[model samples]
Target: MIACLWARAASRKQRAGRESNREQLTAAGNGSAGPMSKKTLARPARGARGGTRRRHLTVLFTCVGRRVELIQAFRGSAERLDIDLTVVGADKSELAPALHLCDRRAVTPTVLDPGYVSALVEVVRSEGADLLIPLIDHELPVLSQARQRFEESGCLALISDPGVVSTCRDKIATYRHLKKHGIDTPRTWLLEAFAKRKSRSFPCFMKPRRGSASFGNYVIHDDEELHTLGRRVPEPIVQELVAGFEHTLDVYTGLDGIPRCVVPRRRLEVRWGEVSKGQVAKDPRLMEIGRRVAQSLPGCRGVITIQCIMSARGRIRVIEINPRFGGGAPLSILAGADLPGWIMRERLGEKPRIRMDGYTDGIRMLRFDQSVFLDRRGELL
Candidate 1:
């Protein structure tokens, strides 16, 4: 029966390929068939575990492009855990260190199909990925699917619940969920359509409900700017732009639902839509808030970076929560929290000792560009 099913699946794939070819030919001849819809772009879901799957620790990093800045940080952190790191991105060729860590310079195949869930499930089975950590928010859906399929397969997925991930990914839903849990967040409203019913005070932040890397984050000063921003991104959000220092509290929770280590850091500088330079700080308030937010979420495992803005009123308002290993994860490590090592130890049933010292203050980091050799000719040249 299994063999018959496999054969039928193969036959369907072959037929689909043939039909796709015919459509391609038709489009080529007509010159106006429009672009082909990327049905194959669906990310895959985790599959059922057929046998007793080997529990090899695999860390999956998902990204849209080659995130060179954070790749080095992740690679160095993963080395401390003594676990193989596999990065999954669209432009796999650009992930040099990740590919090197896997000991394969070639591009690892990606689940381009929107069926990313099924594609990832196949990968989990084939590559034996036990822990799937998302490096980018865009890959949240696939991670969500993995969590769902793991139950049926009895496979261990080191990820949060799908509903939680979805709710966190969408800022509107995240604010709602936090509010429902009595968590403090910046005053925000969803702008479904342009409405001048009431004018908000100037110096507000206009952002899309769903996005990453500050793709469309803008600060609108006046009503005119808000209107322009509303036209730019639909369903935009306008929040009171808090004035004060911004800080991120990077926290790691355990299986027992306790806050393991909360490392606070201040963003010194940012470039290309990423936090470049950061310094660790000992902030008790940040840690306290982080613990509360972590407990509020369901299936809260892995690393979460809580972004908070200190208001002029001397109050820290939660701005956003990234429920995954963030770009500045390494900074947390430097701050005396061995986050990567902690994750591995927890999964392996070993108790980890959390520490945060020597990072009280007076440490600064700056990201500067160094000269690079693009291409070179061989020996004599």
Candidate 2:
């Protein structure tokens, strides 16, 4: 496979008018697959008299493409907690750099394939995966539905309920749900509905309603651009253009369906759709909004990534919600909120000590490009 490069961010002055901070840094990432060799399928630890014991956790990621940092973070957390951990990855492509990094890896069908879920479930069962984290949005719905099958096999699929996943997957449904719950989201409409209105707004935002990773997103300057770009996108939705500082909130929830931590990080730069340069803002307002979402979204478990913008007047407008670990979650994990550790500990019947605002503020993540060299035999060099 060829090397993949992430472009360096342009100078601040050059970027001032180039991209909207609001929507450019969405937190979606490539799906991860599962590997084997380490599964926390060990016996339940003893109590106080049981004393502290080392546990094992076999973690699997689906569509595991390029999330090296995330995989490394989980490994680091396990080390700190004295847990025996085996990282497994599942992907259709052997060329995925992160797939090669897993403790074990398996090739699988694409998320769109009818056999995708069955293939993944088989991976979990075979690998003895204790936790399954689905990285791509396209697979979330199917994973949510088959969660029981995973549980029956003693694997915890880290996914929200089917209804919660549906609400987040559809952009139109997201807008309506946020509005109904009294959350401030940008005014949005389907392309057909927005186009029929005679009074049209310029400089609106348009993207495929079911899209991710900022793909097919356009900032329309006029009716001509709107119609032109809208046609180019599949199942487009037009939104009233918003202005403000873009911030992504990484929210972590407990098994009881309650949120325990929320880390608000400001996106300073982005490569593709993931955050390239981000700083932990640790704003209380954003934390409150995250809590509200946890309240509004029933049956929501595990980590949920949210994108939003805040104006000079302190008004916050929510943009999108992703019910999985954000691509930039490494930054928050580094700030001291070990979400992966917490999730595994909880699954192992250990209580995690978490605080809503304990993460370090002002710690910035400045990303750079690195390449993996592989030989003709597909072996890492």
Candidate 3:
């Protein structure tokens, strides 16, 4: 139904002339970047469907906090695809910086609130949102479970199924799932098991079993430190720490549960548990691991984030799995993965032209803070 509307609205063609069209993207995630084939044509979407009932594809983003880069990327990609995009920023606070610039702003209860789902459903209806993206890890479970509610409102929630989301939310579950499927992952244990076992190595790591963005994480060097910090962190789990260059794989998994693209970037610097400086590493081994990991994880939907550690000798160990877009996703987007654009194309009933390793390599992102200003009246200046 949405495809019909989108197709009808995109009756006009885009101006398609771009400099160094191939340079528009780096290589595919692991593939080489080169000139775009002039033989291929992008879909037409220059203007309204030659009619007056103008309807743009409305996308509602939950917890739209400090995601200005993403908002800009979506609008830019939409234009390239001839899509008229409308972004709705939904948050609990009226002061969210990203909210001020969205096509529409919706203030609602936090994800933990009992009324959150219903409020989101209402937002979907009122804003004519065809797509809903939950940005935070804490909201994954709730949004996945309530996906049906949004679907009833003719909106598709860009998340995995409830069970998939549940498994991804729990660190222990992710560890077990990866190990059970013959994937190389860091060894993990519950706090109780660590106490019973004496062979555990020192300098291990511990964090909340359900933690996100590396919060409440500790690096323990001995039993005393482990026991002391374990008591402080809620639902702590101990895991062997594989030290080396940390690499993040920004994977775009289609709604059909297949990975469309994977871009592995080595984290050069991390701030508040998010990547601050990073460069793409198109090592075949990393690319292969990403493919296997995505294939093993059942029901992965939309953008899937995988964190891994690679030793100097070239061994890679999986560390974390986030069933949503990562904070540094703009890097991949700018590198030419076109994750946002591909997602839009898929919903428009088009087969995305994706190369699993087609994104350019060595693309680096240096992220900095950008401020949004508003008057005391809470209106954009």
Compare the candidates by lDDT and give the number of the best one: 2
The sequence of per-residue lDDT tens digits that candidate 2 reaches over residues 1-381 is: 011111111112113323322111111221242343242334432211245655777788988888877777777777678777777788888788776566676778788888777777777766677788989898899999998877766677889999999999999999999999999999999999998989988889999899999999999998788877777999999998888999999999867779999999999998898899999999999999998987789888899999999988889999999998899998898887789888878877788889999888988888887666779977556
Q: Give the lowest summed-lDDT range of ten residues in model 3.
A: 19-28
Each candidate structure's count of clashing pairs? 22, 22, 14
lDDT of 3 by residue, 1-381 (tens): 122232223222111111112111111131222232221113222122344433256778899888767777777678777677877788888788877657666778888888888777777766557788889999999899888787766677899888778878898999988988898998999988987896979889999999988889999998899888999999999999887999999888877889878899999999999999999888889888888888887788899899999999998999998888888888888788898888776765467879988878898888777666768876555
Summing lDDT over every window of 10 consecutive residues in candidate 1, give the lowest-scoring window. 22-31
lDDT per residue as tens, model 1, 73-150: 434545555444443322234433332223111233344555555544444444344445556676665666667574
Give each prediction's root-mean-square deviation over alpha carbons: 12.5, 9.9, 11.5
lDDT of 2 at 291: 86
Better candidate by TM-score, 2 or 3? 2
Local distance difference test, each candidate: 0.57, 0.79, 0.77
- The clash number for model 2 is 22
